[model samples]
Target: MEYASNASDGTQIAYTVVGSGPPLLMVHGSFLTHTIWRTFGYVKALRGSRQLILIDSRGHGRSDKPHTPDAYAMTNIVGDLTAVLDAVGVSAVDYLGYSFGARAGLALTAATPDRVRSLAVGGGSHGAQAGAFDRLFFPGCADVLEQSGMEGFLEAWSSHRMFPIDSGTRAVFSANDAQAMAAYIRASDADSGLPDEVLQHFTQPSLFYVGSEDRIRLGDTRTAAALVPDSELHIIRGFDHATTMAASEEVLAHLERFWDN
Candidate 1:
């Protein structure tokens, strides 16, 4: 485990550098940390041929958490990512993002196309207009935030039928700082929307994966895949938003092929 500071935004982001080869940065989803990648064997699988860089998004895991909405803006988040890469002396690298992390990756590519060699986005979409199932799943999130704090949010998150956290994962979830978790939730809420022009311009080599059972952003993902000329889309069967990360063997395989190409 190694720590990197992004002083440009006054945010100190923590990241782990594992593996050896071409640089590959991993950004995690909301309400979770880079630890999820370790728990799911993503790091181990890619460690041999890729320099896996795992990051704890602001307000999650070991990264600095800011309470104000301005601190978590999309521009700031992308800047934080760039700062991490700069601190590590990486000029360009492949990026892999899941859900919230995926959205961030897209934002980064749009803002700084030259810095991203390739992109792999999972469990993500192109816009904020969620589907019916998503509305139901996320119904009254503000209330949930007020009552449950971060732990309650994670408990409810784990309870969802889509992804169930195992005992070992559950232990890690329990140990997270509540304030940081809440800040992440707020950051996500503040930076939820994706622009159509940016999506259309994301022409870099890209791989997009989503669970067939994911109703929230299916349409958006389809639209994004079609817009990017060099992008490929893979829809996994028997999976939903949460389980997509755990059972992502095919996703990793797609990345291997994409990077090799």
Candidate 2:
């Protein structure tokens, strides 16, 4: 069942807890909901071995859909995670975040390292605000989201895909609130990502991975991983940005080992 946690700013964040073991908080990328963990098979694979804490970030899923960019400031996003954890009474958790979620995870760890036992970041980076959405999707993609809505953004997004999206996936994409997504993206773009000095001090075990073909993120992700002591890095062969997550079995193989060690 889903539960609600009020963020510092009074925005309600939605989350769910499942399984029973060491808690693993899973945060999804932008344009996707917490349920992506289930749809993409991560929940099924890890649920038996770990208690899963799945959260819907403020502007997506069952979470409050705030349309103002300021509402999604990185601080607020981090507060949302901490709020959810406090509500659930989980003092600390092994945290896993992908893409946009990965970036948020980095900031969260930097701000409150004591709350995260380990950190796993996928398709993420440790750089300052660099108009990533513009480069990741297209120039002015955030503008496209604001002016033309989710349909327009998805049309552009579909053109860049390496594989066909399943119907269920499409439905999820279709269900997004475009204006809220635009605000989230815009706020994220304004974020100053964690500095290398901050990462060099990470005390927890950390894992960083990206697809071999995810040229956009490979260098940044690798560079960031290098800063952490004893962190593991995996380059999933024959996959790009979107396909990296779709190749769930291959992705999980590396993660299983990481979690075990």
Candidate 3:
């Protein structure tokens, strides 16, 4: 069942808790909902061994969809997460965030290291707002979403991106609110980012993973692993940006070892 966590701004963040063991929080990337983890089998894989908390970030999934830009600032996103944990009465948890979710996770870890046991950032960067990209991604995505709708946006996204999005991820992607997602894309880089300078302060054990073929994140994840204290990097060969999600089984092996220790 899904539960509501009230953000400081009165936005209701929806999340679901499943399984039972050490608490674990999973945050999905932009343009996708918390259901991605469950649909991809990550939840079931860990359900027996951990209490998985899957959250729908603002403007995504069942969470309150606020069109205002200020509602999705970095601070608000992180606060929404902590509110979920507080609502569920989970003090600290092993956290895993993907893509956009990872950026928020980094900020969350920097702000409250005590609340995060270990962080696993997959296909994500330590500093995405300032990262090197040959082209503007989100701005273009926002335009496509606004003008073309979800189908058009996905077609454009898949055509330009490195990997083919799997059926499962696509199904989850199709269910997203178009207007909210467009707003999400525009608000993505508006916040004060979690820069490389902040990594030295992250003393927790962290694991960063990316596909070897995912040129967009490969360098950032590597640079991040070096900058984040006590962090390691794992690259899955033959995988690209979207397949990195499809290759969750292999990636989860690395994450399991990281959290198990």
Clashes in model 1: which pairs? none
TM-score of each: 0.87, 0.93, 0.88
Question: Under the 3 Å rule for N, CA and C atoms, how many clashes does model 1 have?
Answer: 0
Cα shift from native, residue 244, model 1 (Å): 0.6
Over 172-228, each residue of candidate 2 has an lDDT whose tens digit, in order, gives: 888999999899888878877777999999999999989999988899899999998
Those runs of model 2 whose alpha carbons end farther than 4 Å from true positions after fitting are 156-169
RMSD of each: 2.9, 1.9, 2.7
The better-scoring model by lDDT among 2 and 3 is 2
> What TM-score does candidate 3 reach?
0.88
> Per-residue alpha-carbon lDDT of model 3 for 51-129, expressed as tens digits?
9898988888888888666777787888898999998998999899988778888888988889999988977765545
Question: Candidate 1 overall Cα lDDT vs. reference?
Answer: 0.77
- Residue 152 CA displacement from its true place in model 2, Å: 2.8
Q: Could you give the candidate ranking by lDDT, starting with the highest?
A: 2, 3, 1
RMSD of 3: 2.7
- Compared with the true structure, all predictions reach lDDT values of 0.77, 0.87, 0.80
Going through the candidates in order, what is the number of backbone clashes in each?
0, 0, 0
Best by TM-score, which number?
A: 2
